[model samples]
Target: MTEIETRVLRPDAAGIAEAARLLGAGALVSFPTETVYGLGGDARDSVAVARIFDAKGRPHFNPLIVHVPDLDAARRFADISGPVEALAKHFWPGPLTLVAPLAEGHGLSPLVTAGLDTVALRVPAHPAAQDVLRVFDGPVAAPSANPSGRISPTTAAHVLAGLAGKVDAVLDAGPCPVGLESTIVGGTPLALLRPGGLAQEDIERVVGPLKTAGDTITAPGQLASHYAPNAAIRLNANAAHPGEVLLGFGPMQSDLNLSVTGDLIEAAAHLFDHLHTLDAMDRPIAVAPIPNCGLGRAINDRLRRAAAPRT
Candidate 1:
């Protein structure tokens, strides 16, 4: 594992300045987002962005999202049209991502775009993230702060566990409230690039209906096999397969049941953490199919990817 300098940040000017300095120096800074901790760097710095891909072993073909201080700053990377602008105004500072054409002279590094014309942008609601971006002058190219093809980090420990020696710093902001990736909406007719902390219906209510992308999605988190753990995962009720371990959502249990709460929020909160634990259990894993609604949709999306036939 690559060794990285890790620092804990408090909500103070000193902490913000330290984080800004690390980013300015082209080092990867993993910080809290309302959705998940993000492994980020200066979006305009090709060298810095390359460091992120190298740190996470993230594929060059898969794009990254730009985290801005606010909607105004977000507009710098992408041209915000009427509908995109409306959604950003209403749902930004929350778990919503808008993909739009890059603005002229946006100066975003090509590595961040993976050669795509569009850029994925979001204004996270996490206070630590907001403050860091606010004090910093440049855009942060961030993806979920974890190893590529693994479960995303929802808490600082998750970052420390997977990225402790892989990045420069980590801003612990307690357990992520949303505990999932942001809802990415883009493409023609405005589709859901990835299901996440936000629901598809909530997005439609504000921006009208959205088209859900197919299995081979172009945006981040759309790959058929992603957000996986070390151990094999079986989705639906397929835990009974020989040698398979289990992660049940409600009453079911093959190895560990998330809970009897039957609440998607509760399940989402435990999802990745449980997957991590199951990996530690050193066995095959199985997860109950969560309902396809709200965060459940996002959770199931990850589970499906995890359970897909591994290469």
Candidate 2:
């Protein structure tokens, strides 16, 4: 594919209009969501959707999450009922993606679902994302803006650095607040397809226990060795070994700290940013142990996957 110059669109009326126009014309745009930056394309356009996979080097088997303006918009494509309905009522317009059966005559490109019977839909809470979706006025199939199986981008700079010429443009609205990806839940009796910005315990209180997703790649973000850095990673470390940089969780001195107070919310927001910072330093990563409770589960999940053996 020939490289095209990527435009950095400001967060303004002009930017939103341009973004919507570009998507309507079947072009890929990278914009910020609360969880992370999302590489977006008009979901109904097969060519645009396929370009997303090509740009990110994403496997066709792994699905993409369709971002909509609101829950009502999402209902146009997916049968959000039962557990999906219950979860959507509580978590709509937040960091949650619900997998549900496709609604009849849903116009999404088959590539968005990777040929699955269900589709992953999210009503992102980011104001910029909301504005783009509202003005664009259609479902957008988006995944993390960074290259596939690499660190997810949390800022406009990260997006530019990783995907500069591949996309049509980036809607720059500054850094993402909820730095982790949205928590994904679906399936019979409700299941946690992927742990994320929302805590598991918080969801359990509303929907009782959730079944854990198995090794089967039923959802996006389920790849075994993903969100990886170029350097090797060692988890559960108290300090860095020689030639390694330490990523600290709680109050401790190191190359960088996720949270000085050990707050999971703060840590979750810092996870990707810190990894990006440290990864650029050209050394291995030694991560300080993160508690496996609450949002830490999502942090650890990313770390484990980042540290996983590459294929």
Candidate 3:
């Protein structure tokens, strides 16, 4: 494919407006969310949506998450139920994505849901995301702004590095605060599809004991081998293998530390950025054991997937 020069736009009012205009015109724009940057296109425009898949070389079966400005806008696309409503009331404008039944005639591109009856939706808390979504005033189908099954981008430079020539523009709003994807919750019994920025305990607190989703590819980030880097990953390692980089937690003398103080929140915020750093080293990576609690569960989940053998 011929490379197209990608523009990195400022987060000012004019930049947001230009990004919105590009989305309306069926162009791909990468913008920051509280979690990760998303490569977005108008959800209603199949041509634009196809560009997202083509740009990332994403699989057709993996669904895209539609980001709306607020709950009212979200309601227009998905049939939000009481449980979904309760979760949305508390977690919307934060880091939780609710996958629900798609409303009839919702006008979303069929490609967004991969012909499934459901659609993934979220109201991102990022101010730039809010401004762009509000100005665009439509559903924007976006996946993480990187090549398929690779490390998610937490900064505008990461987006440009992976997709600079493929996307029309990237909204440069600096590094993402939450360095993980949103926790995806959905299904009739309200299962946790993907653990991410929001802790599983917090979601269970909102909606009782949540069931774990089965091994089905119903949502984004559900693939067996995903969120991987170029180098092979070894998990729960006490020390790096020969020539391997050690990504340590709670610091016991490693090349890099997620958090020396064992703060899971800080670790979650730095997870992807650190992975990006380690991947650039062009060496195998080893990670210390992360406790399976709170945000640590989400971190471990991502690490395990990253370590999974590639197909």
Q: Each candidate: what lDDT?
A: 0.84, 0.94, 0.94
Estimate the Cα RMSD of every predicted model relative to the unseen true structure.
1.9, 0.7, 0.7
Q: Can you tell me which runs of candidate 2 are displaced by over 4 Å?
A: none
State in Å the error of residue 51, model 1. Answer: 0.5
Q: What lDDT, from 0 to 1, does candidate 1 have?
A: 0.84
Q: What would the per-residue lDDT of candidate 2 be over residues 1-311, giving only the tens digit for each residue? A: 76989999998999999999999999999999999999999999999999999999999999999999988998999998886888899988999999999999999999999999999999999999999999999999999999999999999999999999899999999999999999999888689999998889988998899998988877899999999999999999987899999999777989999999999999999999999999999999999999999998999999999999986
Write one digit per residue (lDDT tens) for candidate 1, span 258-311: 767688988887888788888887777767778887788888888888877654
Off by over 4 Å in 1: 214-217, 238-244, 252-255
lDDT value, residue 9 of candidate 1: 75
User: What is the per-residue lDDT of model 3 for residues 81-172, given as tens digits with 9 covering 90 to 100?
Assistant: 88999999998899999999999789999999999999999999999999999999999998999999899999998998899889999999
TM-score winner between candidates 1 and 3: 3
